[model samples]
Target chain A: MTTTAPARPAAGRSRRPSGRRAARWPAWRAFLLLTLPMVAGLFVFKYVAIGWGFLLSFNDARGTIALGDWNGLDNYRRLLGDPAFTRSLVTILLFTLFIVPVTFALSLGLAVLVNRLRRGRALFRTTFFIPAAVSYVVGALVWKMSLFSGTPSGVANSLAYLLGHDDAIGWVAAVDPPLYWIVLVTVRLWLQTGFYMILFLAGIQQIPAQLYEAARVDGAESEGRLFRHITWPMLRNTSVAVVLLLIINAFQAFDEFYNILASNLSGLGRADGRTPLIYLFQTALGEQNYGAGSAGAFVVTMLIVVFTLLQGRFAGFGRTAEEEG
Target chain B: MRRRHLGSYVAVIVFAVPFLLPFYLLIRNALMSKRELGSLDWHWWPETISFQGFADAFGNDAVPLAHALWNSALIATISAPLSTLLASMAGYALARIPVAASKPVFFFIIATMMVPGAATFIPTFVVVGSLGGVNTLWGLIVPGLFSAFAVLLFRGFYLRFPRELEDAGRVDGLGHLGLYGRLALPNSGALFASLGILSFIEHWNAFLWPLVIGQDPEFWTVQVALSTNLNQQAVNLPALFAGALVAILPLVALFLIAQRWIVRGVLLTGIKG
Candidate 1:
């Protein structure tokens, strides 16, 4: 997969061209030409639009580019007082806190299982990985209609009935806050853990086979002993990366919630349905309240940035202890 | 040691069951006729198997699902190659050429990784919408073609590439284009192919942008069409599964075809520093 890049050995040369010649071929001209399009196309799209959105948080319709009107900090002031917005923020926090740890634990356990597989390793890997390829629509549809559908005809409800729970509760329309959160987390875990398992497996494989051999020779018979001696320490960084990725993904989650709950939000019920992203979309696009949406987006972005930085700091991601060794 | 192998199989299967069962049920459900599907009772196996569901799905006139598949395949083929080519170009420059501003450029490129696509969706929609690209294939294909992640992968691959080949090319009086074509691209065909498959799968299975842009069924990608087809009031459960099955088949086939390299590439993301 590796490809050698073509070297321009003359790159460092200060080609001292005379007045007209220098004008014709600038020293930094080539670099500018090569990078400007990418910068203009991507950087402007990414950073500039984001910056504009941030500025729009403080602007009324005229001040913001999308829907023009100026009313400074009006959106922010309203956002600070908005109950639904506040609820979403709290819900997202609770959701992330719950989901990240669960997925981490799940991935770690699955990786350990895969690492132990003497055969059918590829089959197991493929089976888990297949769903990772399935689009959010398909996953959401299956989960909604088949897995957790409220109707008696649904698979989950049927199973629940079989298990002696006479109530075939509608998973999506459930009014209880905790129940809704559980459904969301379960679906997220089902979709996500496989990808993380692959990552964890990669980390597991990097733990030299010889170390496990040595552990076995030293009479490490139990799974706990094997993990303690040969697996856990090696997987620490992998775990960190997985946790960080999960946090980011969990915060950014929109599709599953959006699709699963597409039926319910007639604005009449409790708003636990809104993850911060969904809330932002609802407030801005659905409600035509762009200012509030921008504020929400900014808040979510800051929260994620802070969380990532804090996690990376603790993970020692930029430079790990092993790198020093 | 032999006992450990047996133990491993048991452990793997136990772990694999939860992930595998949903898919098992999905296929089982897909095969079941409407009478069986709508039944309140659940069974591991249906009393009979029929292609009724498949036929119902394929028979729909509103969605040119066959055309959606063609559109998806066409878009994927074009976008994957183009995106890979762009990534290779950027990757080559970042890895090979030593410019004064390369670090900053590389940093900027990598920083785009954290820019969530959801945040950009509205503005991107506006841009595409204004350009009259809405309900068009270019709307679907063009946006997905530009990926910072792909470029990063190519850059990582390039970083590991041997320098001697490029030097040898330079020794033979080849310029930048020749060096890339003759020395770099050929050596990296496996990576390119893997990348191609990855990008193709992503574009093929794409839902969000296509959904946002392709408002009409005529322009729908297979994925968008499948989901849209389902959202109607007259819920065609069997037809929905058939559409879904069609959409997933290409990706599964591609994965099977390129399983070795795809798995390796997947593994590489972690193992590579």
Candidate 2:
């Protein structure tokens, strides 16, 4: 594979005596030229800032983001002592526990159905996947204002009226039994299920057709049996990846929750449906308590890291492809 | 077989209605006048197609809807291509170059993918502020001009690229630069388009960071502007709907046009190691 000896001796001994240096220059130049900016940006914006945030979490940096007044462990103590912050953490955990499984099941089921179709698969796929492109802000607003608005003419209210419940329910503002979860869960499902469905479809397609044919020939004629024996096992990697993504996404549930619940004149939705990110956002930006905000951010990050490591331990997420084989 | 097909159609239709209804309502309400929107009667189809809501949204005094839209377009336009270019270059290096340090560099970049945005949210704000990027469009654009996901995607594409073409080019006396410029980049049209579309949509639809950084209405993106309407005292429902519709129109159009590439991009990210 090395044509280096002939070309180097014939062309480079007189013009450029250091042939190896010349060959290396282009790669080094290109690598630095292409990667320098990204590497620098990540260093300053991500790594340095992350370190700064960790330090600031221990300081009493309020009304500004600078670091001067050192108040050791006060922010952490304050945040943990606050019931609101603790409640937000519990809210996110419950939300994650509920949303991840439902999203997983729904997306996988949709993918299986779509993949099995012999006709109009593309149409069904497109129709389902289009919402994934819609921004969370837009989807949340559409759901909040039109579909679940507390007005007689709103879609949910209209349906309620037709079904003999004559009152227009304030679906979002309701906190007793927490009807807002229905709104949050449904909007997320509509926006994201398509994305994971596409993932599952890709996974399903990668399964060898011969395996299914062999199963059928072996008298495993039922679709359920074939799926259990072949399709389920084949999609293990995709399923693990999907669950990992879902857990991460569920923890970082800010956009929809903020747009739907916090956008009222009364106050931020601190009482109900508040996730950790929302709590951190209000703490950091809304009130400018940068220390507590940074502390909350790290707490949430640690939670995510723990979950990811646990999932990886169970699912073999870090294993090399050769090892998996 | 016929019965099974019928059952599939029924299940699909039942599942699709929820996904389709919001879009239908968005378009329906956007086309309706304020009076029609407020009326008790639900007009499934608007009897009169009035552009009043759109006009109000464009003519919004409190929040500059048009300026926000322009800012959103500018930021997304500049950041998407720049980010994709940088990611592709780095990706090419990691894929083709035999440098011993390339392996560690690639791993370092991938490791950044796991850091949640929340962890970096505050410090980034402080850094951007200190650099005088607060309330500036560049504040939003600069921090987002490089993506680890894009780097991974481009690396995946380039790794699978057949080296025989590059070998042929070398035989024809084409140097590495010439080969990358004339051969490799030209064959990566789909990869570029997919990454570009993804970056564009992401920057365009971005909410939290912009909301935090852009305090001035002059620098507000479309998402921030739309959110302001939600929090205002006198909420104009029709105009809000129109704003939501306008905010999502370009993305929906892009997805429809480049449907295949977008789906392929999603699949690639999920399936790859």
Candidate 3:
């Protein structure tokens, strides 16, 4: 997929000059016409908004989103000083750290297992990948209310009862031991792991069958050995991409967190599983503190950028196909 | 080998149950009465099916669940096709045109894909708000139309488009516009279908942006409506589950129909990235 990009249209370009004399006006016009709305919308909605947000982060623009009230880092300082914002950052960092590796391993393992199946591979793949299409909000609600609800009738409580655990545990509300992590982690793992597994499955399928055959002929009798020497090495690019995507998706963890923890009568939880996006949502929208909210946004953005760049550095993400070859 | 196959089957089923169980419970509970749902004994299957929950959810007084469904459907239907069209156009320009700025433009759009959505969250709200977009469906629909990911996908597809087809168009004196409109667009139905389905599902399931923009209950999308039900004390559990079922049914159906294309799109994303 990456390599096909730069193979470019030298053949098309050769014909381009001949057509250029006749088609110059139309080509330029078509290009502009085709690209203008998208470019303009992107510029206004993304670039301009980002610039405006950067400016707003330096202002005291609370209760309003308008600019011109300069506060000179007060918003940043305020957020950095506030424990809730900092705690939310810590919460997300820990969530990412916990979720990324576990998800990576689980997805990779599932991919290997599913890929090796000689029959019903498509059925299992569909069964697993269907959840990827389910909305996180719906998934979270299902998890929180039905699967892990605090009531005795909830699925987890029923299982617990059957196992002789008498108490109906408040999975989302549990704070002292942070049992909420179980709920948070499980829900996210369920929602996302399949998608990544599919990614790994595709990566695995891309490996040449001859590689495995050759490894087998070389007296690599065990499946594990064949996997370790051939499949694992061949899947490096995919593994890197999966990890990168997982980290980004983890850092942007709001939907499940918000739906499970905050989208109830109890309101946003008392510092348990409150991610940066949730915190910023509360700040900017709930309290009308746009300045501090924007500041927090940048802080999280920087965190995401740092993590991505670090991963890219290690993974060599942006290197040209020639460079990799 | 038979034992190994059995073991594999067991492992796959065991791993799959957690993923499948939620949907099972969701559907089961959605069809049960409140009394049935709250009973101490779990009913794995509904002893008697009831549509009371669906009825309640649709007729809920505080939040307009039906309206929310309509809003969600409308927004998704409009946004998906429009966004796919715009992205395809931009992608065609970037892929085919010899314009000097295509490289930078393509990269710039791709770079936007990495901009953590949170960074854009507040400012986009502000921008959209300034455009008198708050409380309007246009606000929700317009910004989402510019998807960097879709642009990249279309660009990737266009880059690999058979040049012979366009060469034929050129010989027929079809200009760039004619070629794209006549030949390229018709030929790229699969790409359009895949991207359009993805965009539709995305917009359908969208919550945060819709919640922020559609503060009015009249404009609440299905996700926002379901979330509102979650927060309310009077909201019935069975009804909530029913509401969720209503919201997810279309998307699940869409996925089943377009499963091949969607899966292919996902694999392509992995490969290209």
What are the per-residue Cα lDDT tens digits for candidate 2 across B136-176?
Answer: 87898998876777788887787787979988987898765
Q: Give one clash count per candidate, in the order shown.
A: 8, 0, 0
Q: TM-score, each model?
A: 0.87, 0.93, 0.94
Candidate 3's C-alpha lDDT?
Answer: 0.84
Off by over 4 Å in 2: A1-19, A263-266, A317-325, B168-178
Candidates arranged by DockQ, highest first: 3, 2, 1
- Give the range of the ten consecutive residues with the poorest summed lDDT in model 3 chain B: B264-273
Candidates 1 and 2 compared: the better one by lDDT is 2
In candidate 3, what are the lDDT values of residues A81-189, reduced to their tens digit? 9888888889988999999999999999899889879989998988888887788889888988988888888889899999999988888788878888988888888
TM-score of model 3 vs. true structure: 0.94
For candidate 2, write residues A42-84 as lDDT tens digits.
7777777778889889899889778889999999999999988
Which is the better candidate, 1 or 3, if ranked by TM-score?
3
True contacts kept of each: 0.25, 0.53, 0.62
Ranked by lDDT from best down, the candidates are 3, 2, 1
Candidate 1 RMSD computed on C-alpha atoms after optimal superposition onto the true structure:
4.4
Provide DockQ values for all models, in the order shown: 0.36, 0.50, 0.63
